[model samples]
Target: MTLLSLFTQARTYLKHRPYPVLLMAATPGSSFAALPGAQAPTRGTGTSFLQTFQNYAFDGFTLIGLCLCAFGIILVGRHALGVYHEIHMGKAKWADLGSTAVVGVCLIGVTIYLVTTASNIL
Candidate 1:
């Protein structure tokens, strides 16, 4: 059939899947590993609780910062397009376009800062 209908059928089939059963089947030891008093798995790095919490918190903040930066880029791009159109129609000027470009560049720069800070958390 058509591509749209095929995608619709696939989406419908996947939406109602038995996720827990599939997850259990995917991991052969899932059911047996749910023992009482079982120790949770660790990477054996021996980091302290406070250090781990700091790492996780910083990582989450970095992720959120990066996401906001990307969203800013999208907003700037949309606004820049409108500014350009307005300039073309004589409703605005080149200064607005330049400002949009500057803001867009600054937002993308923040994304780079976030990525770099991920290695220096705390």
Candidate 2:
């Protein structure tokens, strides 16, 4: 198969599971984990009902970011599993598998780099 076709297939797969991509792209405060400890907020300070509500509302971004990161990880894992299954079923060539593996490794590496480097600028 042509490289274009392979990309088209990947696009189709992503289209069918758009949430992961969306989450990865749009998660709010996702870089909080990479912030300096002093810059990060402490938990459990708000005890009053209104204070609690405000805290939850603002802190929800961090929670969403965390969830999105988890979802993205699961999605990558599923993609790898799908590729492996295709190779096992003889539906994909060995070269395709090798290329896919390389791409997967690069993807994971980039993801790690992004998560590790994400900070105020991000």
Candidate 3:
């Protein structure tokens, strides 16, 4: 609780830093190693935690994009099927197909945009 105790704690922490700390000083383009098992660093690659975070974040974004695409496909399929049934029964006009197409195109565009820009977010 006292300043001396805090100083002592800090001193102890520094004295017993793990082995990675020593290795990191010699590693290129990194303050510390990235997530364990990440590929070795190259020209633009890195062993920093930031790179690891970006990799994980990009994966999360990709998963979200995949889910969105799946949902979009399901939505478009269901809408088209319903409209087809209506047309067969003489309850719907051909113009409804335009709306369904528009919805699908818009979803595709949005997903493409998000996937392309997701990396820039970090």
Candidate 4:
């Protein structure tokens, strides 16, 4: 109902769903799994320690990037929906709306930059 309650609900939701935020903050290495000299000797084996580690590391990076992008999209959508709801209910002021819009745009820009940079590195 009230602005404070709305914010509190959002905060609670974020607190509960922290994995996305964690993934968004992750900084996995840039190297791919099968580097020229990094591959284990027993390449055709079921599972070698080096191969497994490399595979997991590469997968972690990919997963983190995907999660970060998804989180950013979800965050922007949630904020936009919240703003729309507030406006529809006549509870959002012009200044509040403007500030929210600015923050959302900045967030989207940063998210795009991060995803693009990560993609390029990989």
**What is the C-alpha lDDT profile of model 2 across 84-119, one tens digit per residue?**
788889887777767767787777677656655553
Which pairs clash (backbone N, Cα, C closer than 3 Å) in model 3?
Answer: none
Superposition error at 93 for model 3 (Å)? 1.0
TM-scores for all candidates? 0.48, 0.43, 0.50, 0.47
Instruction: In candidate 4, list every pair of residues with a backbone clash.
Output: none
lDDT of 3 by residue, 1-122 (tens): 99999999988877898666667766775634565675543323447889866666667777787787778778888888899789889998888877877887897788777766764563
Better of 2 and 3 by lDDT: 3
Give the per-residue lDDT digits (tens) of candidate 1, residues 1-122. Answer: 99999999888877887696578688977766867883332323237887666656666676676787778778878888999999989999898899889888887787678767764653
lDDT of each: 0.75, 0.69, 0.75, 0.76
lDDT of 4 by residue, 1-122 (tens): 99999999989989999998777666344344445665432324236778766656665787788898889889887887888789879998667777887898888888888877885675
Query: For candidate 2, which ten residues in a row score worst on lDDT?
Result: 36-45
What's the TM for model 1? 0.48
- Candidate 2 TM-score over all chains jointly: 0.43
The candidate, 2 or 4, that scores higher on TM-score is: 4
Report how far residue 72 has shifted in candidate 1, in Å. 1.7
- Which stretches of candidate 4 lie above 4 Å from their native place? 1-52, 118-122
Query: Cα RMSD to native, each candidate?
Result: 10.5, 20.9, 13.6, 19.9
